[model samples]
Target: MNRIGAHLLAGVFRGFGTNAKVIETYEGLDLGKEFTSGKECFPCIVTLGDILLFMKKERERLGNRFNPENYIYFMPESDGPCRFGMYNKYHRIVLDSLPGLDKVKIATLSSEDAYSLSGLIEKEKIQDFRKAAWLSIVTGDILDRLLWRIRPYEREEGMTDRFIDEAMERMTESFSKHSSGKDLSCILNDLVEIVCEAKKIIDPHIPKKPLIGVVGEIYVRTHLKSNQDTIRTLENYGAEAINASIAEWINYTTYDQVR
Candidate 1:
């Protein structure tokens, strides 16, 4: 019976429906229009555009092997500081507008409560905690570094996006097979070492530059258009600007709550 179950499981995994294409939708929205006029608004349309682009790329990559009906796009939501709590609704609305995407699941992870779609998934597969933690850390780091580096170089026509996409693909492939507790620690250490090396590689220039600190709603700070090219404008004026990452913010918030 065990052998039969193993064979069946193998068959299922080999099929397209067995593997889910998880879409990270937290940073998908680009809410630049609302922030331009100093408006405290949530940019649902921008977020929708980001998700659509991701879905299109996924479909192209997987072709017939992509099981759109079985895939899930995870969107994290919170109920504080702004109207961001409605991000899931906005995401669904936007997703519905796109053709052939009616069946895609747009699930939510709420920061306000302990119970969330992600939490439930994690709880149901309790033994997969190690895998989940490793994924959350590694992907969060990679996205953070990529966003920080690419945002500054994005122009009307540039190759930063292509570079980022390729890097993300590589990272994702590497992450899939590495989730054991020992492996997770080793990966985290390796990531820190790499970042340190990266800083060294780019440390030769101490140009007299202005330093600007960007702070605001998560969407505004990360979205290029929302801050009205604030970072670019700062760089144009010979300033080195920094945008704190949402991942770091979340990590700190979680840590503080535990304390």
Candidate 2:
């Protein structure tokens, strides 16, 4: 599990800056399934599936960095009715079912667990959480924007994915040095600048199209399978798709509840 844990740390750190790569595996199937079985659909599950798939790839690439025979993984766990609480167990089941992966270990980091790996990292460098959160938000926003804009002219089946991987790597390197609050602000500004430049480059190629906003349950909106592949489907039909931020869902469910 040590190797897995190390990979997780590296992944998180990389994810914060831009070196991280997120590959979508189950999106196609998930989208198709959700379109038919409207009920019993969970977008969060789809997102978890993507995360797990990426983790598996990362584990393979960084083999034996910490330990060759055993590997460990971590997933964030939450409480309440968000359905996130069950993800840890579900991920374990899924991973175990994969061939040659029965020995893989999955750990959940709870909000209250100060001794968790992420917690340890945050405690050791208090600025990491803020920096990572900011980077995650900006990167997600950029990818979401690109997916909506380029879905129509995407010559290759998974061109959006390759572009996202490249963008993540670029953005990660851009901010890797600056983890302070001021640096985070600079990163945000730079992200905005990059996005603006990208928009100028893409606007000429993207045709004017109707835009559809997808909103509802948290998992459904973020997970491609849960929402019936709404984004891609919309794009295929000449519609631009905008997915509401997951942070909005968090605020609606938790922050609003607390208030």
Candidate 3:
């Protein structure tokens, strides 16, 4: 997942009383590459390495206190020809083959049911959790849009990124605090104010650049490292870039399931 999206999702989980965090990614690509055939999708390999690296570091830190059974890895999947649908199963194989990680649980939210939480979470809390998750994802998408929209026309270099960082932090805190109530009005209002502030960062004197629409495999397009900072590159070349949103896939899967 992209950074903002990942963090906001974690906040959503925390709001529902689940402790979740996005692990450092890309740094463990070598470990992920080593475990799988080179044929796997790049994002799959990257995520595989990320979990492996996190687990290894945690085990080293906790030593005897490390309990793989106490952890549940959340890896969502879709139903389709995309290899993404099989990531959890493949990760399961890798985790099982590893000595200490075999006991760690892998929890999946499937698109087959529009990512229903029927078995993974308490029955009574399912509706609220799903609603919060949806809103959090939408917020994450908006944050990304805010960055791309303003950064290219910023009043000063690096100001857009710094402001976005602050916005993401504030939004994450809001999500964590307000999601439990199952009423996202407060979160939405905060987002509106953030957007208004972001608009102020844009310079009115700078003419708009050629607009570029980026579309591709969700990971490659959104993951800065995977795409080698494609969006920034476009902005540097005097173009504004907009990538597809993460929420689009979530919506598509639901529509597909219904069809």
Judging by lDDT against the true structure, name the best candidate.
Answer: 3
lDDT head-to-head 1 vs 2, winner = 2
| C-alpha lDDT of candidate 2 relative to the true structure | 0.53
Q: All models: lDDT?
A: 0.51, 0.53, 0.90
Candidate 1's TM-score reads 0.59
Kindly list the per-residue Cα lDDT of model 1 for residues 3-56, writing each as its tens digit. Answer: 111222222222212353443433444432322233425455555655676877
Expressed as tens digits, the lDDT of each residue in 119-220 for candidate 3 is: 767789889888988898889999999999999999999999999999999999998899879568999999999999899999999997998999999888
In candidate 3, position 246 carries an lDDT of 92
Model 2, span 1-259: residue lDDT tens: 1111222334445544334333554634443343324343354445445555565565688776623235445556666655676666766666666665666666566533321345334465645654454345545665566656765555556766566556555555555544433446655675676566445334355557897887766555565545567788877777888877654543444454455
Residue-pair clashes per prediction, in order, are 2, 9, 0
Which residues of candidate 1, in runs, are more than 4 Å off? Answer: 1-42, 52-68, 93-102, 114-174, 180-183, 203-205, 225-229, 251-259
By TM-score, highest first, what's the ranking? Answer: 3, 2, 1
Instruction: Flag the better candidate by TM-score, 1 or 3.
Output: 3
- The model with the greater lDDT, 2 or 3, is 3
